[model samples]
Target: MSRLAYGGDYNPEQWPEEVWHEDVALMREAGVTMVSVGVFSWARLETAPGVHDFGWLDRLLDLLHAGGIRVALATPTVAPPAWFYAAHPEALPVTKEGVRYGFGSRGAICHSSAAYRQAAAGITEQLARRYGKHPAVALWHVHNEYGVPVNACYCEASGEEFRSWLRARYQTLDALNTAWGTAFWGQHYGDWAHIDAPRVTPTVGNPAQQLDYARFTDETLRGNFIAERDILHRLAPGVPVTTNFMTALSQCDSMDYWAWGREVDLVAQDHYLITDGRRTHVNLAMAADLTRSVAGGAPWLVLEHSTSGVNWQPRNPAKRPGEMARNSLGHVARGSEGAMFFQWRQSRQGAEKFHSAMLPHAGTANRVWREVVALGADIGALAGIAGSRTMADAAMVWDWQSWWAQNLEWRPTEDHDARERADSFYETLYDRHLTVDFAHPEADLSAYPLVVVPALYLATEAVGQNLRAYVEGGGTLVVSYFSGIVDEHDTVHPGAYPGALRDVLGLTVEEWSPLLRGERVRIEAADGSVLPADVWTEFVVPNVPRGAEPVWTYADGRAAAGPAITRHQLGRGAAWYISTRLAPEALDTVLAAAAADAGISPRDDLPRDVEVVRRTGEHGSYLFAINHTATEAKVPLGAAGTELLTGERAAGVLAVPPGAVRVVRAD
Candidate 1:
């Protein structure tokens, strides 16, 4: 625990017995201190029902311990053996169309199945009792990415569980009916028996019903995790228990991490780059920031990321020279205990054989292997930052429940993507060199001088009041379109369009005017600068008397002359609202202005793509300057310091090489 943890998932069962020793040797050479084991070894561990085999695992753990590497022993519940599926076929998940999934890939079991739960609990108990006090074990990894591949299953068992969950949540049919708005299509559930999982429906099923189903699925999966976690807690006692989470919004969107964050002893996340021709490092920063925020600003780990190109994407391309180190250190700079990849050794067989790993298929002679060894050394040198917390200048509102509701069957336009808006806003903040902490809608915002809500389609009354109080307390607020339109139950707020936020924003959306694909519009700011926007526009009525000023007007669009963007001076602070999806450049201007309003000064001296973040701990403050551009980036330092990466003395200015990362410990 004194040093940063490195290494990745170690699947020794995939290789021959003789390779284990060599694997350990290579691990030591790569500076690996810890690894995750038994993630997909359920079948290998428990060969048949009522039978167990511990000889191999015991030997492997001993080998790892002897090699000075710690084990994050995982319960192989993610992929139950085929024998289990054969015995309890009902445990297999069924699709929304009622097709039962076969036991080929991982995460095939229905979380709500009693048989699966019992079996998973049994395996977890066995693992805990066997290795709870083992010297090799440092952490208990419950499952491999809880909500990946499949989040919800529409099986008969899930149906019954859904009804039970609804009973607990709503208490009665009338309350459930009202919450789900079942009276709309004369689809009121007269009894619990009639209610079922929101399966394939005639047209668009009830949005509220779908929304609740998403919640139910998340809770159900989390319940399985909790069941296993309880076993570990009871038996293992002190060792930290965690289930790696894919917190990056683009990868996984099932579990509400704010809830999951509170359950685990430590927060761990898996983030992979999306090679969609965007600023991927910005996404990496956002994911890291979000994970740290979920961990309550405590240091967390990058449980799984690609060492180079990932195999699952549409196109897999190897990383450029020094890119691997940059990616790993980027996460470390944002409060990660250390960086870890999906695997230590590349597989020779299996679905993920092509996936990049610490020890790639090209062996230790390639760029990946060399970088892996180099990154290990760098991580070791920066071990003093283990418990440090990343500093943030602003907070952004993000909620999985709201994202689920907004992603439902029908909306103003299919082009209106909440994740895109969030990404855009986060990217703008990143460009401004502002580190952001993501907050739940109802979380306290007083600590942050500025708060941005990118796309919160489902905003509870409490969230509206929270934002109002924040702005009234002299905090700046910026909200994008389609927010505050629906409540927690996915019900449209009564009265004005942006129901709950109307008062705080000082504007009412009369009607949404969504443009067709490829359609664009021009909005003229007060300074006569025209900005182009797309995706959507709204008929906005500003509360002029209440200090709502039209900052940007739709110059040429269906909502022409309407406020495209409005700024409301409420109490001692201000709230800005954007009624249309502005281009990234336009968004940058608005966000820059809002930042200035909140008394936040962006690091204007840094070049574009140069990210500067600070991590502070008992070891003193460390400033991380990452240069993503192809030229040297000069970062202005307020005090003299030594660059931890190279142990070079630096004062006033820190020059970061192109496509590299530098960390300076302030003297």
Candidate 2:
């Protein structure tokens, strides 16, 4: 069985029957082996209520099977038939502003709506029963990207559901009140009726209330996913089910993917390049790494990414020649089992008419189409790379709940974005050619010698306890400022600013000074080199436990006399605290010190534009060397082996052209 599942979302129902023949021929020519169908075809599948017209889908599947392609049949639950909302208006999702969204857009139904759940489950059951034993069906794509448009439903039903969820989480109203700190400002709730899902409030609503709302919404969506997934599992026993995740680019508070990842059979991602005209290969790599981690260090899938440009962004810039190939191969280099796209053919009419596809508007003559064919063939040749996992020596901590809590109201500064902070640290490690795996805050930290946790603003006692044990167990922990300051409910921990971490760091932060826009403070390292600091700074008073020491301090600021960076040794390992946001150069300096302490030597001698990552399997190890820059460069192969892409004999030095990828099994 070839594990490289190439091809993409194929919507043959969108075109006439004659076009389907041409699509099949092109699919084979492009070396496509799989096609995802019926993702947004609820109207075609179910015309009115339960009256399903799977006639079109059945023909589509039969034709695809005849063409020797597998199907990842999707339940048309993303966009319900227009008649569904008309028959049941309660299915509509209300936004935080209390406005009910219309049915024209996808994901407009509330996850908390029982009617929507029943309808979704009914359709999924129908699909599974019909295609469960079909020869063409290989996988089940449960629903399209969940929570893309409206993640939260601030309606009366959601409020009732929120109360129910609270009851389940904290049995009694007294327990709920205590957990939410409702006693503040005479807001103590005597009954569960007082609770709502944090709608349009006059001022910053209770932080605990808002936090619970986020949790409730995520669980609600997960419940909906499980409902559909269960139907598929029961009807289609052996078929693996998955849902596409928006990954690092997702803005929805609902759907904690770490929790959702555990439920899915395979972790899949839908990543589109940043359309702001910025280079995004590194961002793509990071998302793939996180998805791989969520999959328990196994190979996953790239369910959907634009073949060229996407329509949603403010300006949809087309990918340059070979850029798409580079992007897809990058994901595969990390741990993607396959490389797929948003669609097989371009849409003639729809909101996403401008979104690029495998067969573009220019037809077979276009450069995008040519590149797509080439990429498909290239991906097919690397079938042996399947089942191989990218081995990483370092891990980065990721918490979706903390992402929501860190961006709430009434913070010391309004500029604390946890994702940006984490990405910065990940980029530093990538530049050093160190592979990084994203681990949950509570995950086993013993696998990696170094762990970098950034801006974990909302931390629990258990999280702190876990990191303390990890460091004491001989692992290096690098935690940033504004971390471990708040408990799970968004309540500030008493005593020191960095609450539980103060003990592990052997320091206590007395006060915090948030920097204004354009304001900068200089931090001096032991080497007398100064680095600019911004956004935030904590005035630290280190207790300096017997094994702890100071690393850096503010050269001049309101907290100029305080320590800026402190390190403490616990058992055999050590923990370092960065008290402020250091400039890029300064951050490198700080991370360099930690890297050195962890005995991780930076692999910096390679060409600056080339990226090297290794994946090991039972067959041995394969090295993926990618040239991200535009110019050609000669890279030293270090060992001689056969290049998997071109089947060329690669010796001591390999000539890598711009936007090229070489997968070699070296000696």
Give per-model TM-scores: 0.99, 0.98
Worst 10 residues of 2 by lDDT: 246-255
Local error of candidate 2 at residue 93 (angstroms): 0.9
Write the residue-wise lDDT of candidate 2 on 241-306 in tens digits: 999987864334456888999999989988888755444887888888888888889999989888
Cα lDDT for residue 598, candidate 1: 98
- Cα TM-score of candidate 1: 0.99
lDDT of 1 by residue, 1-667 (tens): 6678899999989899999999999999999999999999999888998699999999999999999999999999999999999999998889999999898999887898899988898899999999999999999998889877888999988999898999999999999999988889898888899999989988999888888899999888888888888899999899999999989989899899999999999999999989988888899999999999999888898888989888888998888898888888999989899888889999999889999999988788888898899899999999888788899999999999999999988787999999999999999888888899999998989999999999999998898999999999999999999999999999889999798899899989999999999999999987899999999999999876675799999999899988899899998899999999987899999998898999998777989899999999997999999998999988999889899889999998898988989999999
The lDDT values for all models are 0.91, 0.85
Instruction: List the candidate 2 regions with Cα displacement exceeding 4 Å.
Output: 249-253
Our tally of clashes for model 1 stands at 0
* Best model number under lDDT: 1
Using TM-score as the measure, the top candidate is 1
